[model samples]
Target: MTTYAIAHLHQTELCAEIVEYLEKIDGTLAPFGGRFIIHGGRVEQLEGKFRGNLIVIEFDDRERARTWYRSPAYQAILPLRTRHASGDVFFIDQVAQPHRATDILEGIRVPTAGVAP
Candidate 1:
């Protein structure tokens, strides 16, 4: 399954760090077929309030996302994301077909009621 990553920054030196990272550490994701779908750009606030920047990335699967994050290349950029940005970072598995009903169920692991459900 495909996976997506969302990053929202409130007060990060995220831009500068991202530039540095792209220049040097982006190679790690090459093998994983990682791609940038959304970046820090213009956004229209039609709902909730937010500040700083927003980023969204797509990867082939969870493993690639995990690998890219831990890989040396990405790790090299980690400090920038850490020192600069601070908002929300999350990963989600994509659904082949978009459906509101299924969307609600995604990632909702209904644990056995008896043992830590």
Candidate 2:
């Protein structure tokens, strides 16, 4: 399954360090087949308030995503971004194709009133 590394970065500083991070990040991602699907583009806010930039990088699978994140090349440059930005970063698996909105319910277990969950 495809997986994504998503980040919502706020209060980012456009400093020399950040510039360097941007220049070098591509090299780190190439070996892992990770590419940016979204990178700080203009957002159309339809509902709740949103702050800062949203970044999404796609990977072949969860394991590849995990490995890319943990790789030394990526780790080495992580501090460059971390020192200049404040945000949330996480990995999420893509949903299967030909799916329904209710498909997720199958993996969720609701406890019966008399049973311990």
Candidate 3:
């Protein structure tokens, strides 16, 4: 199944060390098939607390997401992110299509929310 990972970073505060730590994580993520669809930017909140950055990453599978997160490189820089900000990193496997239950969901990219279709 295709897995999607959303790494949310709510930076209640930031410091020099935290910026450096995110850099380290960036380097580690490069090797894996990781790409950030969302990063820190200006936006008007439509609902509840919108405090910080939201990072959405697309991975091949749950295993791949887990591997990137648990790998030594990420582990090494994990502390930096923790020290700098309040965040959450999670992966969710999208339900496969009825006709393609045996296949992966990566083939079908779900439309993002807040779109006028």
Number of clashes recorded per candidate: 3, 0, 0
Q: Which candidate wins on TM-score?
A: 2
Overall lDDT per candidate, in order of appearance:
0.78, 0.95, 0.76
lDDT of 2 by residue, 81-104 (tens): 999999999999899998999897
lDDT (Cα) of model 1: 0.78
lDDT (10s digit) by residue, model 1, range 54-112: 88889989888888888877777778667766788888888767557656776788677
How close is every model to the real structure, measured as TM-score?
0.75, 0.89, 0.69
Mind sharing the TM-score for model 2?
Answer: 0.89
Question: What pairs collide in candidate 3?
Answer: none
Model 3 lDDT, full chain set: 0.76
Sliding window of 10 residues with minimal summed lDDT for model 2: 102-111
For this target, which candidate reaches the highest lDDT against the unseen true structure? Answer: 2
Q: After superposition, how far is residue 34 of candidate 1 from its true place, in Å?
A: 0.5
